[model samples]
Target: MARVSQEHLDARRRQILDGAAVCFARNGFHATSMQDVLKEVDLSAGAVYRYFSGKDALIAAIVGEVLDQVHEGFEEGARSTPPPPPDALLASVLSRVLATKESVTVDGRPAFPRLIVQVWTETLRNDELAAVLREGYGVVQRTWARIVEAYQDAGMMRPDVTPDHVARTMMASAMGFLAQQALFGPAPVEVLRDGLRGLMSVPDRGAGSQSG
Candidate 1:
């Protein structure tokens, strides 16, 4: 028998991960069984183990994939604009997230929100998972902080605010809103936009303050 190429192995791993995501989205992390994932991929139990040692590993991969996609989306959004202001750059990042929420689904459900919730819960119980989550969140915070510092340099943000503080606050606000929307229904984007504008201290093209 010939050894499988790295490309082939990666493709197979991705296929398994996709199927695992569907199962996880539908039945959740703890409730989902390896058998369910195997059935989704139409693979034997042994085949599943060849790629992922167990459910915990698979869950980590799923969460890692989601974070990677988000990072890619933000990078693409930032690159699409040549040299926008910090506020505009941050808005571009937010737009990509909103677009992702609209486009990506698993098991006929929005994956990011459910995935985030599941990962947050898992992080509480699993140290390895928590470290992965912390790294992803650190990337997010640092990215936002850099953008905020740029905005401050451009004189777009108030002098009193620190970039790190603003970045943390922005992340907290976005996550909080997403949690609310997931618990209830779709949140009004305009409301979120207005709140963000206020938080970022985006200068008005016209003369006055806008009410939220």
Candidate 2:
């Protein structure tokens, strides 16, 4: 048998994941069995199993991919700049995130949003998934919290605002926006940028700045 090339393998894996994402979006994870995934991809059992052992594995990959995409967007922007102004900093990262999630997947569905929400909903009933989901969020929360603190240190953000509070609030807002987009399709990037601009607004803290 001719050896499978790395590009082909990666493409195949992505194809399976994309199909699984669509199936999960259309039918609840529990309701959609491996057979459903098989149908989604139009692949034989052997071919499907080659990529994912079962639904749990597929769901894990889906959630993992979503988390990685969001994390990459933040890490990329944060690492490339020297703690840029909070407004510019956030604009860069948030725009990357909006673009990343809105990009089309191999299956022609939006890369994220609805698919992520579906897996999130499944976590309510799935202990394993919930654990993974929590872990993923914890990492994101900490990373963003540090960014919040950095902004404070730079005098660009209000020092009185707890880092965790700001970070969590931003995260919650992003999640809410994602849920909305998932249900109703893509939202204008301007609305998101405007929201972030408001959230990250840094009041002038010149000489004798008041914290009240």
Highest TM-score against the true fold, candidate: 2
Candidate 1 residues 1-212, lDDT tens each?
99989999897887898788767756778899999889989989888899899889998887776677656655553443233554455455556666755534664556566656666777788999999988987887777666666656667566667878977876676677667655665656566776666755754465445555
Q: How far out, in Å, is residue 173 in model 1? A: 2.9
Which stretch of 10 consecutive residues in model 2 shows the poorest summed lDDT?
100-109
lDDT of predicted model 2: 0.74
TM for every model, in the order presented, reads 0.73, 0.83
Best prediction by lDDT: 2
Model 2, residue 176: C-alpha shift (Å): 0.5
Cα lDDT tens digits for candidate 2, 1-212: 99999999898888888788777776667788888888878989999898888999999987887778777666654554346654455556656765744544524656467776877788888999999989988888787777777777667676877888876876777778778877777676567667667755655567466455
For model 2, the superposed segments whose C-alpha errors exceed 4 Å read 84-111, 199-212
TM-score of 1: 0.73
Native RMSD of candidate 1 (Å): 5.1
RMSD of 2: 3.6
- Candidate 1 runs further than 4 Å off: 1-10, 72-91, 94-107, 186-191, 198-212
Q: Estimate every model's Cα lDDT from 0 to 1.
A: 0.70, 0.74
